[model samples]
Target: MTIVLGFEGSANKIGVGIIQDGKVLSNPRRTYITPPGQGFMPSDTARHHRSCILDVLQEALEEAQIKPQDVNCVAYTKGPGMGAPLLSVAIVARTVSQLWKKPLLGVNHCIGHIEMGRLITGAENPTVLYVSGGNTQVISYSEHRYRIFGETIDIAVGNCLDRFARVLKISNDPSPGYNIEQMAKKGKKFVELPYTVKGMDVSFSGILSYIENSVEPNMLQEGQFSCLIDRLLLGGQETLFSMLVEITERAMAHCGSQEVLIVGGVGCNVRLQEMMAVMCKERGAKLFATDERFCIDNGAMIAQAGWEMFRSGQVTQLEDSWITQRYRTDEVEVTWRD
Candidate 1:
C-alpha cells in the first residue's frame, strides 16, 4: 500500500492530507480568510498560505501518526488559484521532495474536488455540478476526461454571492456563502433577480450590477431602498441558490445520467441538497453529496487523486513541474475507472 501526502494551498485555504492506497488517513485545513473589504491580493494571500501550509501539513501528519519521510509521494496544487497561494505550496513541496527525495506531483484544484467526491461517495460515473465561490461547472465523465459541458462564462457563482453579501453589509466571517444561506432562511419575498443562462453557460456579473445599482439609487433618495432591499435581503440568496439547483438538475437531465454528484464549497448547503434531492427523486435519479468535512477546498481530494495516479505509476518530475492558474480538468488522463 503506497502512502501519499497532498498539499492544497489554492485560494484562501491551506489543506494537507495523507492517504494510503485509496483510503484517506488524514486531512486538515488552515484558513486565511480575508478580513473584509479586500479582494485577493497575491502577496498577502501568499504570505497567509505560507503560514498555514506548515500548520495544516503538520496537523495531517500528526492525525495520521506518521512522519514526512514515511510518505511515498508528495502532491501539491499547481494552479487555478492565487499565485501567492500556489507558490506557498510549491515552495514547501519542493523543499520536502528535495530533502526526503520523494516523488512530487502537482494536481489540478478543480479535478481534485471532483475526484475527492468520487472517492467519498464511490460514484463511478456521475454527472457533476460543482459550484464554488471561484468556479461553477457542469461536468460529465467521458473519454478518460471530466468534460465541462457547462460553466460560468463570467464571475463565479461564489463570487456573486460574496459581492452580493457585501452589498447587503453581511459579515464576511465564516463564509459568505454560509451567511447568505442563513439570511435566506429569514427572507420572505422573492424580489426579481436577474437569471441568465445562455446555452448551458451561466453569467452573474449582470445580475450583480442590477442589484447593486438598483439599490444605490433607492438609498440616495429615500435614505434607503429599505423595502426593495428588504425584498432582496434573505430572499436573493435563496433565489440564487435555487437557481443554481435548477440549473444543475437541468444539466443532469441533459446528460441523461441516472446519478448526479454535487461537489465544491457551495454543495455543503442543506438548501441546495434539499432542492436537488427533490428534483432527483422526482426523476428517479440518484444524487450523492459529500459532507462539509470533504466539501470546500481541502487536501483530502488531492491526496485521493494522487493515490490513484501513484498506483498507475503516473508521477510528475520536480525539474519541469509548473503551476497554472487556468488548468482545465480534461487536460490530464485519469487512470481510475468505475
Candidate 2:
C-alpha cells in the first residue's frame, strides 16, 4: 500500500493525516483562534502552525502506526490560505520530503473540504454549501466541474461569528466560534440583526457593522462579553446563535438545493446542524454534515484532494505554485469532472 502523509497547516488548524488509497488512517486537528480583528492573518496563523507542527504531526503518525519511512508521499495544503501559514506547512513538508526522499504534492485548501465532505457523507455530485471564517460559497456541479452558484463578496461566515463574539467580549482562547456558540446557547430573545444576500451571494459585512454599531460594547472590554446583558443575561448566547442558524437556513433556501452538504468548522455547530436538519427535512432534501474532525481543517482532506489531482496528472511544481490568499472556487481546473 502506498501511504500518503497529509499535512494541512492552513488557516487556524494544524491537520495531520495518513491515507492509503482513499481511506484516512488518522485525521487529528489542532485549532488556533486569533485575537479579534486578526483571524486568518498570515502572521497570526504562522505562529499557531509553528507552535503545533511537531506534536500534531507526531500524533497523526502514531495514530496511523506508521513511521516517516513507511509513507510513500507527503502532501500539504499549498494555496488559498494565509501566506505565512501556508509557507510554514510547505517548509515542514519540503523538509520531510527531502529527508525521506518521498514525492511531495501541494493541495488546494477549499477542495480538501469538498473532498472530505464527499468522503464522510458519501455524497457524490451534491451541491456544497461551504461556509467558514474565510469562505461563504453556494456551490454545485455543472459541465463536469464544481461551480459557484453564489458566494460572499467579502467576509466569510466564520469570520463574522468571531468578530461578533468579540463584540460580546467572548475569548477565542479555545476557539472564538466555540465561545460565541456557548453564548448563543445561553442567548435568548431574538435580537434583531442584519441578514444580507444579493443574487444568491451573501454578505456579512453589513451584519458586522450592525453589531459593532448597534449592540452594546463587549463587557470584557468595558463591562464583559455578554451582548445579552443589555437585555436578559439568561440564554442570551443561545438566542444570538439561533439567529446565525436561521441565516444559514435562509441561505440554503435561497440555493434551492435538495442535497445540501455543509462543510467547515462552524458547520459542526450543533445549533447550525439542527437548523439545517430541520430545514432539509421540511424541504424533503438530505443534509450531510461532516463530523468534527472532517469539519475542522485536516491534512487527510488535503491528501484526498491531492490524490485525485495526482491521478489525473495535476501535480503542481514548486516554481509555478504560489500561495493564494483569495482564490475563488471557480478558479481550479477540475480534471476529475465529467
Candidate 3:
C-alpha cells in the first residue's frame, strides 16, 4: 500500500492531500480572495499559497493519520497554471521530498483532473470535458495520450465569467463564477451575445467584450440587474455548453464511446451538468462528474495522477523537475492507461 502526498497551487487555490491506492485519504484547500472589484493577480495568489501551504499540508497529513515518513512519494502539479503559484508549491514539494527521503513526481494538472475523475466515478474510457479558469478542452484517451478533440481559441470559459463578475463588482468571497451562477438564476431577459464557434474550437473573448461594452453600467434597477445577469449567464452558458456538447459528441462519434466525464472547476456548475445530462440522455451515453470538492482544483487529484505515474515506474529527478505555464493535456504520455 503506497501513500502519496500531493501539493496543488496551480492557480488561486492552494491544496494539500494524501492518497492511497485509488482512494483519497484527505484533501484540504484554501483560496485567495481579493476585493469585490478586483481580480486575483498571480503575485498575490502566489504569496497566499506560500503563506497557507504549510498549514494545509500539516492538516492534510493529520487528517490522513500519516506522518511524512509514511509517505512513499511526494507529488506536485507541474504545469498549465500560474507560474508563481506553481513554483511556490513545487518548491515546497521538493523540500518535503528531500526531507522525507522520498521520490518526487511531477504531475500534469489537466491529467490530474482527468485521472481523479475516473478514479472517483469509475468511468473507464469516457470523453472528457475539462473546463477551468485557465483551461478548456475536449479530450479523450488514445494511444497512451489524452488527445485534445477540441479547445478554446481565446480566454477560457471560467475566465470570461470571472472577468464579467469583476466588471459587475461582485464579491469574490466564495467565487465570482458562483455569484454569476446565482445572479443568472433570476435573469429573465434574453440578451444576445456573440457566439463564436469555429469547427471544434470555441472562443469567449468576443462574448466578454460584447457584454462589457454593450451592457449599460447604470441599469441596476430592482429586477433589471437580476434579469440582465440571468440573461448573460443562461445565454452565455447555453451557447458555450452547446459548443462543448457538440464537439464532445463529435469526438464520441469518432471514438464510438458511450460515456462522458466532466472534470474541472467549471464542471461543478449545476447548469452545465444539466445541459450535459440532457445531451447524454439523447445520445444514450453516461455523464460522470464529481462534486466541487474534486471538480475544483484539489490536491487529491494531483496525488492520484502522480501515484499512477509512480506505480508505473515514473519519477522526476530533483534536477529535472520544473514547472511550465503552458503544458497541454496531450503533451503528457499516459503510461498507466492501456
Candidate 4:
C-alpha cells in the first residue's frame, strides 16, 4: 500500500510521478528546448526546471487522483547529471518532503532508468545497455551491485549525436538526437567514419571531431547538401551503433547472459533497438526495450526505484540528501534485489 512521489530533473527535462507499490499512477514531464545549433546551458536548464516543477507536481497529483498525504515517501534523482539542474530538483524534493512530513530518498538516475526498464519489459537478470545524453555503459548485476562492464572513455553516444546536430544546425524541439534519427532514415549511402572501440569500452568524441572537421565544411553556402547530410547522419549512426553492439555482445558473452535490456533516452531510437535486436537474435538471446514513455528520463522511474529501496529498508536522512554529480551506477548498494 506504499505510495511514493518522485522528482527528476537531472538534465534538460523535469518530471513528477506518483507510484503506488509497483504500479505507476501518474508520470508527467516538461522538456526545456533550445533553438537550432545550440545545446542547453546548465543555468538555463535549471531555471526552466524551477519555473515548471510546481505545476508539474500538481499535474501528477491530479492525474493520480491522490492527495499529498496519501504519499508515503518522496524520492529524487541524486545525480550524475548537470549540477544546476540536479540541485534545482533536489531543492523542490526536499521542500515537499518536509512540508508533507514524509521520509525522503535519494536515487541514482541510472538505477531509475534500469528499474523502469525492468518494470515495463519484465526482463529478469538481463544485461543492460544504458545510453543517454550524459552516460553510456554496459552493465550487469553481480554480487550486490550493477557492475559496469564497458563504458565511454570520452563523450556519450547521445552527446556525440547532439553535437553533430549542432554542426548541421538541426532543430532541437523534441531533441537533437531524435531529429538525427529521423534524417538518417532517408539516407541511401554510407560515408566512412572513425570506429574506435578499445577492448570492451567505446569512444565517440574522436568520431564526432572527425565529422565536424572533415565533412561539415563541404556543404554549399545555400544548404544544398541534403543528400550528403543524410548519408553522413546514417553512416555515423551505423558506425557508433556498431561499436555499441560490439561492446554489448562482448559483455553478454562474458557474463553468460541470455537477455538484453536497453534503457535511457537513446534507447528510444528505433535504429538502435533494431541493431540490438539483430545481435540478440544471432546470439539466441531475448531483447527487452521500452518506448519513449519509459526510455526517456522521467520521475516514475525515480519513484519505482525508490519504492524498491524503501521496501527494502533503505532511506536517506535529510542531512545526507544532497546530490552527487558523479554518482556511478555501481556505487549504490542495491539492497532491494537479491
Question: In candidate 3, which residue pairs clash?
Answer: 184-230, 187-230
Q: Please provide, for model 2 over 154-240, each residue's C-alpha lDDT reduced to its tens digit, 9 standing for 90 to 100.
A: 787787778766665567777777666655655545555555556566667876776677555443464444455433222333343
Over 111-181, each residue of candidate 3 has an lDDT whose tens digit, in order, gives 99999999999999999999999999999899999999889999898898898777778789799887877
Q: For residues 1-338, could you state the per-residue lDDT of candidate 1 as single tens digits? A: 68999888878778898888778889888776665545557787788877667777778999999987789998888877777778878889888888889998888888888888988898878889888878888899887788888888998878887887777665667887787777677655667777777777877887888768766534535554445445665556656666676677777878788888899888888888888888889989989998778888888888888777777778888776788888887787877753
| lDDT (Cα, tens digit) per residue for candidate 4, span 1-338 | 99999999999999998899789999999999999989999999999999999999999999999999999999999999999999999999999999999999999999999999999999999999999999999999988899999999999999999998888888998999998999898888888889999999999988888878855455735566666565569899999999999999999999999999999999999999999999999999999999999899999999999999999999899999999899999999998889
Candidate 1 runs further than 4 Å off: 217-230
TM-score of 1: 0.93
Q: Clashing residue pairs, candidate 4? A: none
After aligning candidate 3 to the native by TM-score, how far in Å is the CA of 199 from where it should be? 0.9
Screening candidate 1 with a backbone cut-off below 3 angstroms (N, C-alpha, C), the clashing residue pairs are 80-325, 133-158
- Candidate 4 accuracy as TM-score: 0.98
Candidate models: Cα lDDT each: 0.80, 0.73, 0.89, 0.94
Which parts of model 2 are misplaced by more than 4 Å? 33-41, 216-257
Task: Please list the residue runs of candidate 4 whose C-alpha ends up more than 4 Å from where it truly belongs after superposition.
Answer: 216-223
Candidate 4 least-lDDT 10 residues: 214-223
